[model samples]
Target: MILDVQGKAAYAYTGGKPFDASLPSTVFIHGAEHDHSVWALQTRYFAHHGFGVLAVDLPGHCRSAGPALRTVAAMADW
Candidate 1:
């Protein structure tokens, strides 16, 4: 799914029925050179536990559009 935060797009995934806002949201940030697909195992594990998990791509990588990894702040901004 797509979560548009502050007009900046954040891509994610959601399973099961409609998610409940009260439920916790888990954001997974991949390691260097990795993409959201890397978290496939974790995503499935968490979802099975009834948690809302979002494995997002880092900026400049995968579906995210931007410059290459430059700094910690830049990565956080992704």
Candidate 2:
């Protein structure tokens, strides 16, 4: 899925399911040099078992658009 976060397009993999806002949400944030695929199995498990899983590709990484965050605080704010 594509989300408009901070005016930039943020990409999130919804664990092979359509996202439902009313369900419990689990956010998977990947580390440096990685993308949402790192959470593939975990996201799938959570999403299939009554949870809404959102594994995101952080800015400037993979499917997410960005000039990449330069600081910890900026990333947190993002």
Candidate 3:
């Protein structure tokens, strides 16, 4: 799924299901130069078992838009 965050498009893999914010959410953050695909199996498992998975591609990486964050703090803030 894609979300508009700070005016930019943020992409997240929903483990083949629509995201449900009301459900328990698990946000997966990848390492440098990585994207949501890194958590494929884990996200799928969680989503199928009742957790709302948000395996995200950080800004400027893969499907997400906007410039890449320059620091850990910046990424965290985003």
lDDT of 2 by residue, 1-78 (tens): 999998999999999999899999999998777899999999999999999889998899899998777777877778
lDDT of 1 at 43: 79
TM-score, one value per model: 0.72, 0.92, 0.92
Tens-digit per-residue lDDT, 1-78, candidate 3: 888889989999998888898999999999778999999999999999999999989999999998888899999888
lDDT of candidate model 3 versus the reference: 0.91
Task: Evaluate residue 29 in candidate 3 and report its C-alpha lDDT on the 0 to 100 scale.
Answer: 93
Q: Weakest 10 consecutive residues, lDDT, candidate 2?
A: 68-77
lDDT of each: 0.69, 0.91, 0.91
Candidate 1 structure, TM-score to reference: 0.72
Going through the candidates in the order shown, the clash numbers are: 0, 0, 0
Clash-forming residue pairs, model 1: none
Of 1 and 2, the candidate ahead on TM-score is 2
Model 3 misplaced stretches (Cα beyond 4 Å):
none
RMSD (CA, Å), candidate 1 to true, equals 2.5
Q: What overall lDDT, based on C-alpha atoms, would model 1 receive against the true structure?
A: 0.69
State the lDDT at 17 in candidate 1: 32
